[model samples]
Target: MNLFQDIRALVIGALEIMQADGVIPVGLDFANVTVEPPRDPAHGDMATNAAMVLAKPAKMKPRDIAEALAGHLAADYRVDTAEVAGPGFLNLRLSPALWQGLVKSVLSSGEGFGRSTLGAGQRVNVEFVSANPTGPLHVGHTRGAVFGDALASLLDHAGYDVTREYYINDGGAQVDVLARSVYLRYLEAHGQEVAFEDGTYPGEYLIEVGEALRRKVGDAYVGKPEDVWLEPIRDFATDAMMGLIRADLKSLGVEMDVFFSEKSLYGTGLIEQALDALDAKGLLYEGVLEPPKGKMPDDWEPREQTLFKSTEHGDDVDRPVKKSDGGWTYFAPDIAYHYDKVSRGFDALIDVFGADHGGYVKRMKAAVSALSDGRVPLDVKLCQLVKLWKNGEPFKMSKRAGNFVTLRDVVELVGADVTRFVMLTRKNDAPLDFDFDKVLEQSRDNPVFYVQYAHARVCSVQRKAQEAGIVVDDAMLAAADLTKLDHEAEIAVAKKIAEWPRLVEIAARTHEPHRVAFYLFELASDLHGLWNKGHDDPSLRFLQEDDVDTSQAKIALARAVAVVISAGLGILGVTPADEMR
Candidate 1:
């Protein structure tokens, strides 16, 4: 039902016929040939580079080949006219009947109309929002959570087997800091005074964790040394912080399929096994890394360490896996984690990290490349910072999260639907400004409102048609006389609908769910444009007064727009509005 794909197939068939008639060479590769929507709608419904791409390869002039191909395409009933533009680019204007029939197809298919099979069922692991398990998630994590969840859903829509994952950073010095902070709160519950040092967390959120620990142990560790209670308290505090993080993600409608722990790779042979696999490939060796460029650190030293040959796989330099003191560096666990993912037999891997982690991308990709022998591809997406504004000033920090605004704070003020949609209004790598007053404004400048209003308008039309005793359900509207929708404005909306499947494939291929948000806005503009035109000409209205047959035809087109909008919003994890208020 993809009109662009259907027309491309028609063009390819014509080229093959020309080759058979000896009009062109027989062995030209047609893979480079493409049929896409013209940049300007006035050019034609679709444009193809078949003539231009084949001209040099076929040893013939582009115009000569375009003239012969146009003749063959003109014979098809679906093609209205095939015209050659600059440099022998072929533009095809499809018949209005083709666009009219697309309305029926959209109604019959419902939301499933634009689903694609681009990934061919490949298993893809999407790891995102893997914030350290030390506190509640902040606004930075919110962007990553929304981006990752939407990406997983988009891959699922495009036929990829997607697994949403979170990696817990529990095996680190930060958890030790959390443990001592909880101990301070525990002492406070036992009628003792304690001061939080610079290294300990001082957030009010951990006060409950302290109270819960006092209730569980009955002050057993109140006067104990650090060695006696540090280990057990570290485990307890990590579990509590993870519980808080789970609740925060649930509030924003994000759920993970797996929660991996960095500690699991320790006390086990997993890290050794991963490094050994690389060593077996002749990629690991004992060497001293070159000093970093520019000013040297006060503690900088050149010492022999166990390093990986990351540069061979495309990194800027070989990276250290083990420090000079025989302890694993931070990069070791990351390499081991990706190795475990490769061992799980996933076809591909994606990591959604904060923008600060941009430097780690190449080395991590190299690790996966060497681990899987280039079989599994890894793509890392970094989400930039989000600036919050309210009442013409910067938003205040959250006391609950200590120094940052918690994810729950944003969701409480705007609700989950608005929070999710607004987070995706910008590209992941671009800084986003989330303005409370502007996002809530009911106008075209607000993308979430504009898209939702289109869906709500269609619902209003259906209710009016039902009250007039005319059936407007999907099954009935799909059977309407769609040829009655021959007006140019109405046809334009149908043209926008025709781009849905193609847009889905492109967005999924690029691993950019923001494209879906962009396409939804454009489609809404077309739907609203046609709605405004109906006021000037009563015959163009969706619900024609006292005409049942014509009303069904027009209503069918509007419902098709809603179907696409609901599907797009569903991919973004936002609930479509049936009424704006």
Candidate 2:
């Protein structure tokens, strides 16, 4: 069903024939040979750099090889003509029937048309949104959540066994601050006045957790010291904050398959086991690190510390595993977590981190490389900041979240579909401006609305055709005489539809789900363009008042567009709109 792939196979077969016939040298690497759409549509339907890439390797002139290859390719039934252009590139003009058949293939495949086997069923664990369990998720976390969820879905569609996971930063000093803050609220709930200190969380969301704590304990530790209540309260507060975070993610339709606690890595001998694996490979040592670049700190001193030879695995320098005081550093647990992932037998690991975590990328990759002995590859995607705007000014912060806008605030303002779609409208590492007013506006500038409207318009066409007593189901349209779809404008849409399967593989290979959003917008534009063309040319309309055969053929093309859009939106974790409201 992948026309481009099918054609590429034909090109490869023809090149092999050239080799057998002694027209070109044998054993020229064809791995770099590619067949894709030409840069300018006027050039041809498809272009291949086979001759150019093979020229130097095959020890032959590119033009001579291209001319010989073109003769072989033109004999195929699918190729109408193969011409050499610009000194070596072979351009192909496929038969119009090929494009017509692509529309039928789309109708036959439905939403599964673009699904791929790029991952080949390999197991991949995607860990993201590992925010500290101390408060509701804010706007920054929302970007990471949406990007990670969409990437997981894209990989799933591209045939990867993906597991969505969240890492809980519960074993940290921040959670202790959360416990003290909840205790203040707990005291306030018992009709006692309390003031939130500078280091404590002052968000009103913790008020309910404090009230719930009173309900559970009945002031059992109201006057107790920190030693007796800190542990219990810290556990209780983390649970409450995680619950709030779960609700926030649910509002945006994100769900994780696993929630791993950082505390679980501690006291379980997991850190020791992970380091032992590294130590066995002679990666661990006791050394003093050089002073950090720039003006040295006042207390800077050379002290012996447990270090991992991260530089051997591509990190900028060796990293510390344990401090001089014998306490584990922040990175120790992260190393253990990735080791756990590798030990679970996953073929690969992907970590979705915020842009601020950019500095941690090389070291984390080095840790996984050393732990897995380079058996498993790690891909880290860093999502940049999202700026909120409204009324031509910066949006106000959420009172519920204390100092930043919560995910729920954005979801409630527009909707889950809009929030998810808008979040992915940009590259994950590029800063995004989420303007409340512009996103909601019904214009081409709004990609979510534009793509959704195209799907809705197709639905409207189906409804009108059904009212006209036309049988327009997928089976009927798929079996229609698609040769009647001969207009250049109509063929242009089918050509775009043919690129879906290729685009899916590209986006999945690059781990960039924003490419899907961008492709959907372009497809929508092509669909909208064809729809407008129908206004001036009565013969181009989907319904021909007196000819059912031609009408079904044109309607079949429109339905094909809907099928691809639905599949694209599905990969983005957004529902395809059946109608615009």
Candidate 3:
């Protein structure tokens, strides 16, 4: 079904024949050999740099090897012609029937056509949106949530066992700030005027939490001192904030397989165990770090602290695990959490962090490397900020979230599907502009709408075909004579369909789910092109009156396009629209 992969196999087979016939040296490495679509369609259907890659190693002219390889490749039934291009690059034109067969394959396979086994059943843990348990998720966390969820789905589709995880930062001082903020709201509920100081959360959403606390305990904590109320309220407030966060994530169609609490690492011996694992490997030691290069803190006196030898595993410098006061640093628990993941037998670990956390990437990777003894690989993806715009102006701050745009605000403005798809329209590390006006616009420039429109158009065709008394079942269309689909526009659509399998493999390999959005745009464009061509040529239309056989063949192609669109959108966690409303 993968035409590119099939041809690469053929190329390798031909090269091996060249070796057996003594035309090329035996045991030449074919690992670098690749067969992919040429940059320009004029070059050929596919191109390979096998000759150029092997020239210096084999001590032979590239053209001599390319010419010899071309002769062997041209003899294959699938390869119509193989010609030497610039600098001994081999350009190949596949037989027209091969492309024709690809369309039929898509029809037969349905949505499963593009599924790949490239991951080989490896277990991968993807931790994302570990936003502090201080408030409901904001606009920035929304992008990371969508990106990480889509990445998990993409890897799952490509044969990886993916676990979506969320790390709760309840052990930090910020959650303490949340507790104090809720305490102010509690006081206000007791008919006492309260003011939010500089560090306390000032959002009105906590008013409900205050009202609920008043309903539960009346005036018990109203006249109590800080000691009597602080611990109990901290636990209650943390749980409430987690409830709100879970609801927000649910609204965006996200669910986590695990919710690891940083507090759990403190009470248990987990943090100590994780650091001990590193220490046994000679990675932990007492050390003094130099002051910051540009601007040192006011209290910048150097002090000996417990540190991890992160430099051995590629970090810029060793990082502190314990402060000079013998308290665990913020990074110590994170290292322990990753060690726990490594001990769980995952083959790989992935962290989707915000771009602001870019400085932590190297140290985190080093921790995982040392903890896992280089057996497990960790990939860190940084999600950039999202700037919101509305009515052609910057969208102001949210009252509910105090100083930021809440995730609920976004989901309310545009439904969950639009929110998810628009967030992934850019690479994870690139800034995203989520313009409320532009995203909901029905024009082709809006990627979510454009891709949805393609699926809706296919549904319209199916409805029209069925109303005209034509059999539109998948089995009937799949068995139709596909050779009747010979138009250039039809072939171009089929070519795009062929790219789906290859696209999934590439996106999954790179762990970049944004590429799926890009591929959907291209697929939608190809489908729209075919739809427009029908207006100019009646024969290109999916419904053909008085010609049931040809109509079924064309409908098969249209349905296959919808099938791929639905699958791609499914990975994005965006519901494909059957009709634009």
Candidate 4:
């Protein structure tokens, strides 16, 4: 059970009782009332704004409302003290039994302790890392990959049916460039000297694709014209590049459920069908867009184009869907793809894009809004650039990946677990610095190591308890005499554990996986703080040499911390370290 939700319900019940009687006026809305942890710990365990938010409608002084609410809430056995603070706040300190009982709840529930039902079975689609199959994935795509995968996992944890997806941009002219690049390599494989022009992809990763083509066709199209060899080699090279991309994602532990191709929308009339839907809604038009704000209308020549009236759905201007040449713009296939997702009956849609795509956000949202008839909600998360560092200097580029840092380069330098965890230390929209030296360092300054060290510390304590011939199993720990855990410092750590469920719901609702990382760091800090206290004061140690019940109670608390840490790490797709070297 969620303690925060339980306390909120109790507060709402008190407000309802006050409304029914003459204490407060009838028909006053209490929807705005909230129960959250006090900002300052000295105030109380939990605070409520019921009195202040309802005072205007109830026509009573804030203190009067607070006084009445406090009296009503203090009657509950869980409320050890309820004090009326400034203006209209009601702060309540819960009995120590509740905090101590949280340890048992954590042990009993295990990894499922913080799982939430906030989504209520809504089906959502998360599309991310739709990188062009031109080369191996670079660091720019790596941030989006990790963020999308973790967000999808977060949604699953919060009771949503989530579909992880990748949209391959294979229909564009970029894929044509890829085909030509592979063709050059194929010529070289056939013992013909070939030159890579400006438009060709010259990465070494594509050399294998060229050799595979030679092996498959046996120089059948060695000297053929462009038209003869273009189509077949395009398919072959795309397949090969996709294999490399999948392997790159595997190195980072990111797996997607669906890989939708942009090429499928072109010949199948999917794009036309989506445009027809918009046409029926009168959201499509044929016209010339106005010039820039500084230019006069007469200064610009008229160029007729097919456009979508995206301004109806909150975009700043109508977006062009087709040029005057009757060719589809990049926006057309994107609209069709999102329409397909909506047709699949996903209640909501999310797209994770690199920060360079910020300008595309409004137009895409408008397209989805028009296509879905405002029935589905769309959220776009933009991941900013990641600046790599090493030994207090900016990390250099990968020689293998000519222009940028390759995803494989990062995963190989640091393990996959460290790469994934370090990428999520900052919010998706904020710029992140991935320090090669700092992230792997075993110090308090490194968040990845700090959180993992806490989990490892708990394992070490459990091992020590076992060495002393103490059985520290979850079943026995759950039933331990937790009343022995009455110290203020011990109770503080239990309170941090209590915040996990609430934090999960908040992070899931906001679609921010970084909050999970931030919360784990705070939880680890508390666990380590308590462990240090035990060093100076023998009574605070987890293992007591003489008594079994007391030892079980203390060790239960430590084990509970590990349970939450493991679950948090699991959500991030990082393995928990049992021991750090």
Candidate 5:
């Protein structure tokens, strides 16, 4: 149960009672009313803006409405006191029993305690880490991959039907570059010396691809011309690159439900079908007769080209779908792809792109808008760059990836859990500094270990309790006399546990998985604070001296914290450590 939601329901109920008693008008929009944890815990456990939002609409002063609402809320047993605070805001203090009971709910629900149905089973297609199939995934793609996977899991926890997708960039010129690169490697495999030109990939990762090609073809095309071997090598190289990419993604615990290929849209007429759907809606035309503003290209000239009327939706300019030479621009294929997504009957589309693609957001949204007739919504999230630091110095390029740090390199250094957690420690659109040393540190300053340490400590306590002949199983703990859990510090930890359900909804609604990481940090802090308090006060210890009943009650609270931590870490694709070693 969400205590914040419960309190909001109480506030709404109180307002309804006030209306029934004729203390206020009968009709006022309560949609804006919300109960959230006060910014400062010093204020109260929860705060509501019901009075402030309804004052102007009800033709009553905020204080006047707050006083009436507070008086009515104070009658509920769950709310200890509802005090009207500054500008008609109501601060609520819940009864200790309510927070104590939350611990029981958490233990009874186990890993499913914080799961929410806020999404209501809506179909959401999340396309992410669609890196070009030119090479193995690098560190930048690692960040996007982790973020997208966690987001899909977060939405799934919130009850959305999520489909994780990866769009292979095999239809671009980059794959041809890969083909030429591999062909050179193939020459070397046949005892021919070759120099990699500026356009060809020279990474050591492709050496194995070359060796494998030599094994499969037995040097049959070693001396063939470009026209004879280019097409076959291009297909072979792309498949090899995809294999490497899949391995890199698997190393970081990411799995995609769909691997859509840009090449497939070429032969299947899907691109034409998508554009025809938009053209039928009068959103497509053959006209792009204006030069870009401010800085025109040296080759700039007004040419009639196929354009989409994206300006009518929400774009800076009408975007070109076909170039003057009758070839589809990059934006055209992208528009057709999204148009196909809309026609596939998805309720929503979310694209996780790098920050460099920020300029494409508005036009892409406009295309989806015009194609779906404003019925389907698209959310584009831009992930910023990840800067790696080691030994307090910026890390240079990797030897394996040749130019940049490969995803495998990062995962190898810190393992998958630390790599995943550190990637999500910052907001998606903000720059992230990933320090190798800090993430591996064992202290409380390292949030990943700190959260895992809390879970491990609980496991240690359970072992100790079992050795002492105490019953700490779920059934026993759920039936424990929880009234013994009355210490101030113990109740405080339970209060943090009560925030899980509410935190899930907030993180899922905002499409921000980092919030789960932040909440896990705070929850760990609460647990550690309470654990430290036990060193000073023996009564607060989770394991009592020969008092089985009281010990089970306290142990139940500790297990409840572990439940939430495990669930949150599961969403992040981090395995919760049962022991630090």
Candidate 6:
């Protein structure tokens, strides 16, 4: 099914034969030897650098090794010809039978065709969209949500045991501000006008929470002191905000396997336990931090504080874990959170943070490294900002989200599918422009539309073939006389299908789901190219009126393209279109 992988094995086997024949030295490293598609299709179907890579190590001329390797490779049935190019590169022309066999592989595998076992069932925890439970999720959180969800799905497709988690920022001063904001709305709900000054959330969404609080507790806590109302209201307000966040994520088709509360780390002795784990490693210390790096803060002063030896693990400087008053800093709970992840026996941990949190990466990684004794690896992906556009104009801000574009705004404006797909058009570290006009367009320039249209075209072929009274189910396609598919354009499409499994592993390895979007775009372009070629050549068409076998064979290839497209889209959390609207 993986043609390149199979051919690389063949190349290695041929090299081993060369070693046996004294053409090359014994125990030459074949690890760097690679068989991949030629940079230019004019050369051949595949190219290998085995000759060039082994030349210096074996103390032989590259051409001599390439010529010897080519002879051995050409004797294989799958390799039609192996031509030496330049000094050492070996270009290979695989037989049409290999491409034809890939179509059968596609039909047999269906959506599972491109799934990979590269991860080997390694447990990975993906923490994403951990926005503070203070308000509705904004545009930045939307990008993180889509990126994290798609990443989790991609890792799952690559055979990783992925746990999607959300860390609730409910233990901070921010949630206290939210409680006061809700209390303001509660007073307003009681027919007393209240002014929302600075440091309080003034969004109208909290008005409902206030009204609901009134329904829950009739006329109680209306005139209570801050101490009497602060703690209980903080719990109630955070839960309300979390409910709103859940609804927003639900609108965009995102769900978390775990919603961990930061407050739980406080009272449960978890934070102390996590820091103690680091302390046992001799990573904790009492030290004096230098003044703020660039420009000193107005209140800058030196004070001895409890710090973590983050610099020993890779951070730029030691980080303070406790303030002068012995209160935990923001970094302490984060360390505890990652400690919980590491202790849960996950093979790896991934954090999807906003670009603004770029400074937090090394410290968090240092914490995980120290806590897990370097046994667990942590990867942090920073999701950049998303700028919205509509009709060649900047999209209006949301009053509902207090001047920021909400996740629901983007989903409701276009749709969840378009929203998710467009969000991943760029890498997580790159800024993305989500244009309402451009993304919803049915034109081919829109990648989502083009890929969806390709899937729909294959569906159209199935409908026409069914109405023509020719059986086009997967069983029949898999059993078709695929040797009839010998056209150049037809073979090209099959070759693209062969790269799907490889693409999945590459994307999963890089932790970049944007590669899947790019690959799907390329696959759709190939499928579209073949469909266009059919118009000029009647024999190239997928459906033939008289020949049932020939039509089934060509239609079989088209169906395989749809199958792979659906599989790739599934990894991206996109529902493939059966018929374009």
What clash count goes with each model?
Answer: 0, 0, 0, 0, 0, 0
How much is 7 displaced in model 6, in angstroms? 1.0
Query: Against the hidden reference, what TM-scores do the models get?
Result: 0.99, 0.99, 0.98, 0.98, 0.98, 0.98
Of candidates 3 and 1, the better by lDDT: 1
Model 2 stretches astray by more than 4 angstroms: none
Instruction: Please tell me which model should have the higher TM-score, number 2 or number 3.
Output: 2
Q: How accurate is candidate 6 locally (lDDT)?
A: 0.93
Off by over 4 Å in 3: none
TM-score of 4: 0.98
Tens-place lDDT digits, model 6, residues 1-581 = 68888999999999999999999999899999998889999999999999999999999999999999999999999999999999999999999999999999999988988887889999999999999999999989999999999999999999999999999999999998999998988888889889988779888789999998888876687989989888988899999999999999999999899999999999899999998988898888898998877987898889999999999999999999999898999999999989999989999999999999999999999999899889999999999989889889999888876768888888888889999999999999999998899998898899999999999999999999999999999999999999999999999999888888888888999999999999999999999988888788899999987999999999999999999999988888899999986
Score residue 282 of candidate 6 by CA lDDT.
89
- On a 0 to 100 scale, what is the lDDT of residue 342 in model 1? 99
Off by over 4 Å in 6: none
Instruction: Quantify all predictions' global Cα lDDT against the true fold.
Output: 0.95, 0.95, 0.91, 0.93, 0.91, 0.93
Candidate 5, residues 1-581: lDDT per residue as tens digits? 78888888888888888889988899888999999889998888889999999999899999999999988888889989999998899998888889888888888889999899999999999999999988878888989999999999999999999999999988889988999999988888988999999778988888898988999998788788889988999999999999999999999999999998888878677778878887898988988567777988999888899888889999988888888898888887898788778878989999999989999999999999988899889999999999999999998888766788899989999999999999999999999999999999999989999999999999999999999999899878988999888887888788888889999999998999999999999999998888899899989888999899999999999999999999999999999999998
Can you write out model 4's per-residue Cα lDDT over 349-442, one digit (the tens) per residue?
9999999899999999999999888999999999999999998999998777667889999999998898889889999999999989988888
lDDT of 1 by residue, 46-81 (tens): 999999999998999999999899999988999999
Model 1 global lDDT (CA atoms, 0 to 1) = 0.95
Query: How would you encode candidate 3's per-residue C-alpha lDDT over 319-344 as one tens digit per residue?
Result: 99999998989899999999999999
Among all windows of ten consecutive residues in candidate 2, which has the lowest summed lDDT?
195-204
Q: Which sections of candidate 4 miss by over 4 Å?
A: 293-300
Q: Report residue 395 deviation for candidate 6 (angstroms).
A: 0.8
Identify the superior model by TM-score, candidate 2 or candidate 6.
2
Q: Which ten residues in a row have the lowest lDDT in candidate 5?
A: 284-293
